[model samples]
Target: MINDTIVAPATALVKQAVAIIRLSGPDAYQLINKVFSKQVEKKQNQITFGYIKDDSKVIDQVLIMSFVAPHSFTGEDVIEINCHGGVLVTTQIISLLIKKGARFANPGEFSQRAFLNNKINLIQAEAINDLVNATNETSLKFAMNNLQNSNLHLIKKYRDQLLDIIANIEVNIDYPEYDGVGDVSAEELTEKLVSLKAEITRIIKLSKIGKIINDGINVLILGEPNVGKSSLLNALMQEEKAIVSNEAGTTRDIVEGKINLGPLTLNIIDTAGIRETVNEIEKIGISKAKNEISRADLVLIVIDSSRELSLDTKELLTLTADKQRIIVFNKIDLIDPTKLVLENFKNERIALISTINNNIETLVNQIMESYHFEELTKDDSLVLANLNQISLLEKVENFIKNAYNNIVNNYPVDIVNVDLHSAWYLLGDLIGENYDDNLLNTMFSKYCLGK
Candidate 1:
């Protein structure tokens, strides 16, 4: 148990209606009682109005919310004092708490303490941070589902199944003569393990989609100069964030913007047109554009519809051919939209667009459809957007598959149990049934102060 008390402002230290100073630990009540004029032995979960006085010097009027140990958020005595929102008033209250033996809390210490005390598992703890930082509705829902330990329940289901399998192996090994104990044959074991593998495979696929939904997609707008790349970016963003000029090479640097298409976000970046330029500054911008192309998750290759593809345009298309991209035939208003046909690149993702016509919704819908996480929402499946969680699950899948392969090879059940046991341990790690201190520290360190 933590013996020392810690305190920090739970709200931003700005001009607002109120500011909250939170404390948690064994001495939380003791520290608060020293400064509060109201009685400290109020019923648990009760809030009382009070005044903070420093040896008869009234510091501020406040509201004291109290929670006793083992039931509070951090599994300790926690107190939250809602004081007036003023720089001087908040600072004075914090300083008074410190003088009363309360140390300032570190970043995520509250949630870290909750995990250490078994009040919440690592997955749920992470959900709290993710919830606070979610960028869109989809990302918010993903984090919200995780807060209910949706992924934890899923891991527990797999854990229980593996434990049953391990128990069967133990029975077969120790009670060879006892027919009542029952044992699973190699063929039956293989079937069960294969079913488990298939479930993990589905989870892995969904996690990939969840990553796109949660982290959003990085899109690079690439083409020869004067192909309306900047105009398309503006149309997608619905704002004049990028300069739109008729002259070539007007966009000398990367212009970035974010657009939300309901379920997904596009971090669109417009780069300098890829063409040979004598100007040194334009050359540097072109180099940066090349670097961005390599890092982009999706490339938007714009082509002029009125003119045939130039040799340089064909080369640029070939460069991003292997990448996940959408070939955009821009300036469609200049051509017959009804007769438009991308015959050569029939297998590629193609979109006919006219930024001047404000017909960019087609491209937006295509991007959304490509990264839809509807599977996760339809069955109300739990989300595992965290990369660490997905990686651990993939490891579990590998171990389970290994055990299945062993059974298929007619190996002894004991040999199969070795791999099964390895899987069980990893599944436990996934739910944080067992954890490394350093791993927990690293995960929670990314949180904002007083989280």
Candidate 2:
């Protein structure tokens, strides 16, 4: 409820230079004044320096930022206590506030309140979360645009367009006598629906890239034993994350590490070498490796050029025949450097490198070439968000497609109106025009406690 005050640490409670404790609700100002040495008036956006005390005993010297009603975030009276970042001090301040009548805030309660009060929509609220956890510059740019309602604008635009069409159809159905009034022919209607669906399809394609950026790409390092698979993981991560062993079958489990290659982040998994082994644990590992290969976004088929392509190497190539893969000829340094001058490196899917020399730049660049993003600089709105946002968009796309099909099948214009309305509502769900408590609970629960 907005009437009761909710207080929470607005920053990580670790030992740092400063920690902020946020309070929001109707009685927020009143609750803060109860414990502070100095009184805080209804002065909006003013920072006051004061001492937090238990009667006469000083607790901590702090700075309080006061935000008065209706215009602040959450559209309620708000207060933020900026104190020393000692965990003990922050915890004490919160405890004092609780004793002074402010209850602890739930995870994402601040953003949730902002949504309920119409300060920001669902997509923008989600964008706020993404902004906090953004890994690289590219993702940060997308998150900032999302904060500015980039995705919300698109969803609202689509929703409004559908609503306008629905209203037009209703009017036309009710009044057939009116000449050139709400007059949308069946052909024109189908065309509009088809066009809308096509636009959504394009966005969905871009959204997959957004997902890869926000959630890192899953890359599987696969090969037979002694093929430098572990070496490849270590080289990419630039760390000794996986043990590089000369002994075959040393790595009998999945070893994972993450590395950001500019905009693209790869969750590299070094699995057990895929070869027939009699050992039960090694067999289990081999089975696990195969399972992971199915779900991998990209597979690095590492082959040791130091030795001849054995039957195991050929079988590895045959296995990843249709997968999105890069053929890595490891131990290229073992090849004559004079011969390297004669060979043309034209193939993007094939990389020749020596991890021993730490010369895997060709493989790294090849990865960046795999995803063709022709300068995502134009518009960030095309970038979709998390699974929830993507799934909702999928629903919108489906409804639009169904609407198009109904129109093409010569169904009544009103029948098309039904799907359009469903799509509009789904878009509303994306932008949070219509939603329930359960949706808010599930989405915001993923957010940080202080957020």
Candidate 3:
């Protein structure tokens, strides 16, 4: 609804066959006419061959496409110029558009406009950003599914179900005299609350799976000096990113990499070797290694297969006993693999690997199988994970749980309705069915210009 139109190059600023510059607002066509010298006498969804010029000089021969208001991405008149993708030509055309009264569009402004015009919901809009930022195939699939509108459709279904329950509650409250069949009774109210709880619980379960798929898992590798931690990391990454040496305490900092196991992203962190040392730098590295272990979703306690377990390994086991862990018996090249016995740490997930032998693929498969990463890939479609969505869903889940508890406690239905309403609104916010202007501005501000 701004007075001035905005324009930006829709394509990446790189060498390509053609670049597209998009303009939107009431002055879109006028700005196009000023910069582009061609008869763009085409209707909606039509492209016309044209030549772009600045005053008297020809900039480039181009094709121009125009979309009328309420029919384009921004729900306003929009013009797109398909110019040759040379940096100089594209820059000059943008400068000319500015001279013709067009301002530069902010990051995500076009998507923001689409949201403002009710062309797409907030969840779908967020999916677009997620799709662009996805780093792996799993992340890409989840974002694309969200953009497909199925997640929004499911959310709407849940919202409608909640509303129907709310309407039924009103019927009981407003018309107490109508003792019609299927009317609300104390027992009937309890049953309805139970059913609602089940429905909400189902959605909450899906959110848990969706969250893991969206955010992936963090796995930390911890071990004493020279235990092949870096070697394992290098093997997983399929590159020698970390310094591997026989010298103890070679790695004195955290090294990170991402490995895909089916659909799960393992943000693997190989930390400095944990060891007691007088050297100031190694001591600091050990401290950081412990800290990383404390924050990990999964911890791998790597032990040298040729040597006995040390005090550091024992202490690590005790500290991370409650966390999901894999006891990695590394250096199979130095061990008699046939004589390997796991009875000592029978309760833990174990993997025997040899980075030198490149025999760690079995370990990788074990890690995926132990974590449910394999099962997750069976269904690739999932919603994007973000703090807002996670928080809102947590609120909804807690409220529904509390409502179920109230029913068990024999609280009045009216009191329970408050929690149900809270749950409903929390889910509503995810889809922008309920949101404030400030929230909208903050979310869209993260987008790149011309997105």
Candidate number with greatest lDDT: 1
RMSD of every prediction? 2.2, 2.7, 2.7
Worst 10 residues of 1 by lDDT: 371-380
TM-score of each: 0.93, 0.92, 0.90
Model 3, 1-451: lDDT tens digits are 4677989999988989999999998888878888777756536888888788888899999999899979998888899989999988998999999988999998899999988888888878888888887766766766777777765766777677777776777777778787763355556656765776676565555556556556766789999889899998988888998999889999888889987766667788998888778999988888888888766877888999988878988888888988888999998889797877666897778888888887887677677666443333334333446667767777877887787788788887788789878888988898887899888988998977787
lDDT of 1: 0.86
Instruction: List model 2 lDDT by residue over 1-451, tens digit each.
Output: 5678899999998999999999999888888888899899998799999999977888999999999877788888999999999999999999999998989998998999998899998878988999998886667877888888755567667877888889889999899899679888888887888888888888787777777767778899998888889999999998899888799998899999988889778989999988878999999998898889788888898887777666776776777777888988888988874454313225428888899999999899888887745634345455775888889889999999888888889898888888888898888888887898897998898888878
**Following a full C-alpha superposition, what root-mean-square deviation does model 2 have from the true structure?**
2.7
Residue range with the least summed lDDT across 10 consecutive positions in model 3? 373-382
* 1-451 per-residue lDDT for model 1 (tens digits): 4778999888888888999999999988888889999778845898999899999999999999999988899999999999999978998999999998999988899999998889988778888998998887788888888887655667788889899999999999989998758677777777888888898889888877787777878999998899999999989888898999899999989999988877677889999998888999889888888888787889998998988888868878888877889888899989898877678788887888899989977777667666655777643576688999889989899999889888888888888889899999998887788899889888988987788
Q: What do the candidate models score in CA lDDT, each in turn? A: 0.86, 0.84, 0.80
Best by TM-score: 1
Clashing pairs in 1: none
The local lDDT score (0 to 100) that residue 333 gets in candidate 2 is 85
Superposed Cα deviation of residue 65, candidate 1 (Å): 1.4
